[model samples]
Target: MSSKRRVASGAVLAALAVAQGVLAAPGAAAEPDTAEAAPARIHEIQGTTRLSPLEGDRVRVDAVVTATRTFGSSRGFWIQDPRPDDDPRTSEGLFVFTGRTTPALTQGDVVTVEGTVAEYYPGDPATTAAQSTTELVKAHWTVTARGARVPEALALGPGTVPDALTASPGGSIEHAPLRPDEYALDFWEAHEGELVSVIDARLVSRSTDYNELYVTTKPQQNPSARGGTVYLGYDRPNTGILKIESLIPFSQRPFPKADTGDTLTGVTSGPVEYDSYGGYTLMASVLGEVKGNGLEREVTRAQLRGELAVATYNVENLSAVDGEEKFAALAEGVVSNLASPDILTLEEIQDDNGPKGAGDGVTSADETLRRFTEAIEAAGGPRYEWRQIDPQDGADGGQPGGNIRMGFLFNPERVRFVDREGVDATTPVAVERDRRGARLSVSPGRIDPQHPAWEDSRKPLVGEFVFKGRTVFVVANHFASKGGDQPVHGRFQPPARTSEQQRVQQATVVRDFVDDLLAVDRRANVVVAGDLNDFPFSPTLRELTRGGTLRSLMDTLPESERYSYVYEGNSQVLDHVLVSRGPRRVSYDVVHINAEFADQASDHDPQIVRFVPR
Candidate 1:
């Protein structure tokens, strides 16, 4: 079952318990006759890997405090049995919620907690928040003894850890534990809310804003040069990496700024909990210092001979207001990393004023392109000319006043732009037969601007170019963004991708235009390249290549090396370059300068392909 259904089920159990008069109001005194009731062992209260059999029963547990969260939404402390049971399937630890009131308890203090056994979901129960934690709520506590010995933490590493992060098909944790020794989800479920330790773990990714570290006990699989593991395909499971969630409510400024491959040693103790963002996170009580590994930056690819390079880059909402620093970095990426491509299709190029709410109809990107081109020349690269047509005021959807659109940059020394007259933002350009066989009516024009699919989205820009006495038709596209899509690890099992419907329609429009060109001349040199915003395996891309008129170059890449963007822990592809059958592809590569790094100039990694004209 999905996590949402399990939470709903727990809500029902809570209602039943309240109706039976088993649960009392907060701070309410227990039944007067129960003064002689014997305290229950922590393991008996936490019966199995799933729900507690004693849930809703008023029980008293005697144990020693292991960790405490004095503040934050989950103001509570963890108590574990000093002498644990022989069975490894049942945990001996539990979290006692004291609400906003602080309890006078310290680590290693022996205490007896009397409360109603209730399962609680951290945030709102109805939302995407996953599994409910078995917690003791609406209770009272008293110190039985002070400064007692704390329970020894269970050590976790390679052989003891499960191979796969999840066992379910869609990557959701199952409601109940399956084989605890086989899957990570099952093993974590068995030890829910228990104190555990991971020693000498390697940092696989940078710490998040919430001061959480993603570490692995073993070496990362498909390790990239920058220290992150490159997710080759969905065929294999994760490499037993886990997140260390911080309970420190104050500033995490003292936390180290370590890169990938760094080592973190010492005893890192925490109680495991299921979090919405990170699947199973350890709310740490004691975390170790990060030691850097002296990792260096990745270099650029070498330029190939007798090949014309074309690149696609999404300069995340570039405009004049961003100043020179961002532009200079982008120029270096384009020239050094991309090997000074002859034709560069740029996406997310904002208006002159940028995101500064200066209304639409601004229509001037001269200063923006000039600054970028100047930066390229300053970086010891060629001075390139740019071409674009501004969109109608507020017609394109992006950051409100930014008016972001797609455009092109080309080196005049290598290629020449073929310009035609009478084209505007609303004008829909078409292919026509001329003395030069098949050609665009107006070069650098919008494709099917009147189609409903192009509403509030970027329109495909078609441009005609001549390189080495051969005409090449290029289409620059920036499809609708993937907004409002459900997260991969959300409550919904096999989460819905609602944004794909609009992209399917957009793909059809672009494919029809390509078909019109192919009808005029069967073997026309056509190259479509840009930030497609859809994976090569998605249904939207399937529609584009349905008739086999255009083929995605991504198929030529090895399965392990076909990613241009990283989201969560998976490396995926959202940018593409498709070519007709006429051209000969020399090489293609997606540069890994950004995306995996914490200090990234842009969220996407640029892609370049070298091909020879027919």
Candidate 2:
């Protein structure tokens, strides 16, 4: 057997990794008679079962336990199946299914799971990998009750009550505690294409900034349906500011008949459980039951203020284009939603060349820039004025024609733009290439040689806005890319080529710039705003607040009202307005507007802050 195969086999019998070492709390483990013990040592099994299985066929099995995931009522993990050294199918692996009975098994929990050998034909790796490919390329084995079964352990936060041991179903079952996050990560990847069930799952009340869901394996299903904290979302048509009521969990739920630990089983999909702003939770399954409870009202726009605030939103791929109509509509929407706010910072608005940046048939990058100026002027209350980076054709780590840019618009009647400077910190290519001993190039598009100096340039648009006889230094910037395949998502490219390191370097450059600005102007009432590509706790952002150079506006606000963007159901605070060292002359706040306003238009929300210049 190859070295890799041997390693794979070793993983099957290896002990599970510790999760903060929290063992079964006070008699939480299952009884000795009910538990199944793993074989002292398991046998090795490998090869693709391209053909149908021989009736009653039994095969010895040993493979590395890649991960254990939970969705609905099922718990499962993946194992790399060994194949011939030269076989194109060598990359194949198998998923071992388990029942969802909490003190539920966790990620990296290596148990000897055995079942009848099954065969499944190969299909699109992406599709079949999640389906039943294992049935065709069968390697069936059922684990015996010889492996040590850790006694059932009670959970700390939300306790559980083990139900009566119903008929042991057909197959034997066993379990152990596992790390929640690791379990969620592995489960989503392994069963990403299958069906699953969940029970007694409660909806997490808070909004995930990015609209993503996060669950805590078994933890999310404990106690009763109402006690389990799970984030919820749905697949629907039409985008922009999806209402919280549209999500399934908020509108409906099941009763509390079955407790959290009761075993529920179903086909599994991905993202068994995960962590987020609220906590962790488990995904639901096909056969899962929700105790019928009337609808619950969790989030409502009535919770928002009617005026005087910045509303941050993602203008999905707001590219530099010819028609300023789209920009005009967006400006119109902002004006309608906010109705007030002396200043507004926008992220992802394309403005490649100052206000004249152009692309393809587009005349300039600031098409929206122009539209915004016009729209505000048309609105008539407070005339608008704007400023943006000069897209000097990629002069300073700037995009071609300054395609997608970040800038702000001020209500001239309310405030005035005093002076400003850009914060460009992209390290030069020569410096990076010299450090790595090789030339660096990204697949999406290489840095332009003609615009050499552009690589190290990224400046936060720091504008001095005068309001009520006080000056507020507003630093607006958009951070590095998220690097995914979807254009609606942050920029995506290969790791080495479109490396995060480059983005990190860019962040460091900005941090230094902010620090210097603070040093020179001690009394400056600085407020940093814009879409920072990274999350709040991300290391780069941590540095910005390390020495108290900046204070997060969200930190001073209530939780429910903090988020500025929603991704996949998860509400996150990506767009921010940070304050600097000085008296609080101006207060920062997210307008807390309805997300439906931005679902289809853009991927970001606009953020506004009110300042009474000191």
Question: Compared with the true structure, what per-residue lDDT tens digits does model 1 show for residues 127-221?
Answer: 64366677787667666555555656667776667766545445344344445666556677667777778998877765654566777755655
Q: Which stretches of candidate 2 lie over 4 Å from their true place?
A: 1-195, 199-314, 319-329, 351-363, 375-381, 394-402, 419-458, 484-500, 558-562, 583-586, 594-600
TM-scores for all candidates: the values are 0.80, 0.49
Candidate 2 C-alpha lDDT tens digits along 1-614: 11112232332333332221243321111221222222211112222222222322443333333334434353355443322143321223444444342324443333333343343222343322111223211222222212332211111122221111111222211111111122221222122212223333333222233333222233433212232221221111011111111112322443213221122232222222222221222233222332323323122121123222333444644554535666565655566555645666665566533334434433244655666567656654356666654433343333455455556677676566654222222321121122312211211111222332225444444555556665455656666555431211111111122334544665555555556555555665666667676556555567667778877776675543445654443445566667776634455545533332222334454555554333
Which structure among the candidates has the greatest lDDT? 1
Error of 1 at 326 (Å): 1.7
What C-alpha lDDT values do all the predictions have? 0.74, 0.39
